[model samples]
Every structure is written in C-alpha cells, then in structure tokens.
Target: MGEFKVLEIKQSIFEDNDKDAEAVRAELKEKGVFLLNLMSSPGSGKTTTLCRTIELLKNQLRIGIMEADIDSDVDAKTIAEQGVKSIQLHTGGMCHLDADMTRQGLKGLGIEDVDLAILENVGNLVCPAEFDTGSVKNAMILSVPEGHDKPLKYPLMFSICDVVLINKIDVMPYFDFDLEKCKEYIAMRNPNAKVIPICARTGEGMEEWAAWLKEEVNEWQTN
Candidate 1:
C-alpha cells in the first residue's frame, strides 16, 4: 500500500463548529437573546424542570423553546401546553445538536420577540458535551437516581456546564445520593459551576434557578 496522508476529522469538525458557534453567538447578541442549552440523561426531569421555570419567568420575559430530539415532537407539544412559543427540532439520527443546527432552530423559533431562548437538547451526557451549541450558558440536570458519581464519570459534561441542577432532591432520603459529595466531585472538575439542589416535582429550589436565569438574561441583554 502507498503511504497516505492522515486527517484529523474530529478535530477539524470541532474547529469548524466552533467558528459557527461564535457566529451564532454574535447573531444572538445582536438580537438581544439569551440561548440556554439544557442537557441531561433521560428521565432526569428536564421537561418538568423547564415547565416550572417557564411558570416562573414566562410573564417577565418573552421566552421561546426549541425542543431537540432524534425524531419526536412530544417535548414540543408538552411545552406548547404551557402556552409558550415552542418548536421541535429533528436531528435525524444525530446524537447531538451542533452550532449550525442550533442556529437553524433559532431561526425557525423566531427570536424577534424572544428575550430568552432555550434549547432543550437531546437527553444524554456524552455527545452533547463534546459539541458547543453556541448557547450563552449551558446547564445540566442530575437526578437522585443517577447517583453522586456522575461528575466523576462524566467529567467533561460537568466541566463544560455553567450550572448544574441536582434534581429530585426531595427523594434524597430514599436514595444513597450524597449531595455534598456530588458537589465536591463537581467542584473538582469545575470550581465555578453553580450547583443548585432542586425538586422539579415540588417546586423546591426553583426560585434560585429562576433568579439565576433572570440575572443571566439581564446581563446578556445589557452587556
């Protein structure tokens, strides 16, 4: 066989995607929109947490949602029930949304009147963390059932997240989920990650989440 040139396709793809992500951010800034990328494993109560967040901030901010899935509109319909503007993004068989895909979703969602745009990304820990979706902030939900060692296992995911919401805290007593240990592990990976314990089912600790979002949106809009 003849000698062949090697191509680092993965690195090249990420470099191109990073450029696209920066473009997406510039466009969002021009429109005064804050795009939040929310990620988690399946059954982590992302939808439930989002619904509660909408209830808290919908009146104060013009929010829009982009529900991304491989091939389902279930989440989009669920968000529509809350009376907010929502659109479903089908990623075909892709495991995650890249910056170009996110830009397309934003265009389809119509950010003209939207102050806050949320992308409920595909439910998973691995692929999503590897791709930057051009979000102003990245947040993830970790449920009690998922255990405290998630940060140790998925260090990249935790490290990239600006905030981590520890969900299902109300059931902490039933499970062996160590909240402090989880926080410690997360801190080891990311010292600045804001960790909040919340129960989406009970509306506990949601105010702090909403307030954090509000402050982020205000900062995004003003500066």
Candidate 2:
C-alpha cells in the first residue's frame, strides 16, 4: 500500500483560525474597540450602506473602515471622502480575511483610537463565512435583486451572521424578490439574527439600521 499521510487539513485550519480569532477578539475588547465584519456579494451596495452608516454615526463614534478587496483602493477612497479613518487591505488574490489578516488591517487603521471599526470584507459569500475574522459582530447584506433563495443556497453565511441587511428595498417593486419570504428564510437559518430592510441609496430604513448599530456598539463597549 502507498504511504498515506492523513493531515485532517480542513479541521486543523479551522481550529487554528478559531484560536487566533479568539485572541484578536479579546485584544479588541480590552481596547474598547467594536469590530464589525461586514460581508456581501459584489454590487450589493455595501460601500453605499457603509457611507450612510458613517454619516449617521460619525458624530457619535470614532469610526474606522477597513476595505478589503482582491485589489482596489476605490472603496477606501470613497470611505476617506466621508472624513473618517479608512484603510485598504489587498488580500493578495485571497477571497477572505482570516483572523491574522484582520488583525493586521486593524493595526493599519489604528484601531485603538477607533470606537467602531467596520471591516468591509471581500465581496463574496462562501469564503468569508467559513473563516472567523474576530469581529465583535458579523453582518451580511442581501440586495433585493439577489432573491430570497440565497439563504437556502448559502445557509452557513446566513446561519453565522448576527445581522442581515436587506438592501435596495426601494427597488423591491421592480424585482421578484419577496421580502417576507427572505425574512422567513433567514429566520429559519438564524432565528436570533436581526434583519433590517434598507435602501442605502435613498436612506430609507437607515434610521432603524443606525439605531441597531448604536445599541450594539454601546453594549459591546460596556460589556
């Protein structure tokens, strides 16, 4: 028989990442920094939503943004124009940000002075959900054009997120997207998850989204 070396590679990788994630989370907590790992598909309006969020809370929090992409500083530039601290993280062709990578981004962004650090993770569903980035909370956005069946196709992403934003709701009339069905799908996968519908372009439903964020940040800081 040929020699067989069983590595259990996937299991080992996850275990190692989990340890690093815990350490990163502890360090951030001790520094009073609330990190949010935001994930979504490309063109889901994550940057626009983030811009709206920054506008709403910039006065209340020392906000910082880490825009992770395979290669692009556009989002970082957009965030910087909002007058908040921003950094662009090139993932070197990788599709996700693991704990160590996230820690490095935080260092670049000077997270110690940031009360709220939002990591706009690589624009993908599969890879980002599989790895923990040591964020205080994980959020994903599902635009109405993406359809409600996403939760069924990407259950792990839906299951792991603390909150899910249903973006581009203003176009809900044009698309075949069913809002209730989407909510049902998310609830089935993650009952504890908070789902907020918003049209990031027009600022519709932003107040609710901002309120939830404010509450979460407050809780993260005090606890």
Candidate 3:
C-alpha cells in the first residue's frame, strides 16, 4: 500500500483585489459616481487631459480626480486649480495602482456628491491595464510621439480600454505617427472602444471630449 500526499494550494492573489474592486464599484454606483480609470505611458499628456477635462466639465458636473504618479503632486495641483477636487496617489515606485490603493484615493476625495470621478493611473501602459480599479470605464491616452505602433506593442492597454484618446494630434505634422494605423490597431484589438483625438494643450477637440464627458456623467446620474 502506498500513501499519496495531496498538497492543497488554495491561494489567489487577485481574489481579494477583485472583491475590493467590486465593492468600490458598488459604492460608486450607490453614490451615483461615474469613475474613469485613465491610463497612458509617461509624457503622453494624461495630466494635461485631466486638467483640461476638469476645466471643461466642472461647471456642469461635479468632477474630481485621483492622480496616481511615481512621485509628484504637480498633476493634482493642476487639477485642483481647475476647481475640481483632486488627490495625488504617489505609488512609491510601483508602476500601477491596485484596487486597494484606488479605494484609498476615493475615500480621501470624499466627493460622493460628485457626478464624475477620474483616476489618473500611473503613467505606464503595461501595468495599469492589468488591474481593475472599480471604475465605470477604462480610458487611455496615446500621444503622437509614442508612435502609431503602440497599440500593437502594448495590446493589453488597448484591449482593456473603453475609450482611447489620441492626444497631441497637433504635433502630427512633426511626427511619423500614422492615424489610420493606430485606429486600425485599436479596431482590431478592441472594436468597442470609442476613440477621440485631442490636443489638450491648445484646447483643440476639447469640446467633443467635454460632450462625451457630459453624456457619460449624465448617464451616471440616471443609472
């Protein structure tokens, strides 16, 4: 007779994170908060987009932001100046934010009455796409300089995004970025994603972006 040993490996790292994210979603829904998880690589105009978005929407909707960075309060300050409530989440060297950190940032905002909330995830395309931070939508920004080949290079980020902002289009003439190729890649990876181009610095294409934000926020209020 042979005795067989069966080792029990009952551990799930993402389990608790998923649970926390679900709770965060429920909390936002109950409070009528429309949360957007914004992702992008460094120097992609993500912070500028946040500031411009808040400036455009704050008058109509109560908007707040949670700015996640490797280490910096500059983005948060920029958003706050637009009269939008904002909190900076320094990742302390981490590349991205998990549900727990996002929940903590949300708690700090204390803007339950706000109609819209945007979490500016740490400027890294690879890591931010992996975790769900319980946001209503996953948004991403891709600047012209990052190259049109990015969606293929970082497929996860493109695949998970609900909306994609092709930012810094004003610099299109100076760069080798191809508009059609980027759109094609996005379509191939995530056909459902809504894509918008913008130059957040000059306020170009901002109205359309603001319009989408309004509609998203209004729908949040209703649902």
The TM-score measured for candidate 2 stands at: 0.95
By lDDT, is 1 or 3 better?
Answer: 1
Candidate 3 or 2, higher lDDT:
2
lDDT by residue for model 1 (87-204), tens: 9999999999999999999999999999999999999999999999999999999999999999999999999999999999999999998899999999999999999999999999
lDDT of 3 by residue, 1-223 (tens): 8999999979787788889999999988889898899999989998888888877887888888899988979888887888778889899999999999998999998866788988999889898888889888898999999999999999999999988999999999999999998999999999999899899999998889889878987887796
Clashes of 1: 0
**CA deviation > 4 Å runs, candidate 2:** 1-11
> Candidates' lDDT values, in order?
0.97, 0.95, 0.89
TM-score of each: 0.95, 0.95, 0.94
RMSD for each of the candidates: 2.3, 2.4, 2.8
User: Mind giving the per-residue lDDT tens digits that candidate 2 earns over 1-223?
Assistant: 9999977655665898999999999999899999999999999999999999999999999999999999979999999999999999999999999999999999998986899999999999999999999999999999999998999999999999999999999998999999999999999999999999999999999999999998999998998
Per-residue lDDT value at 67 in model 1 = 95
Residue clash pairs of candidate 1:
none
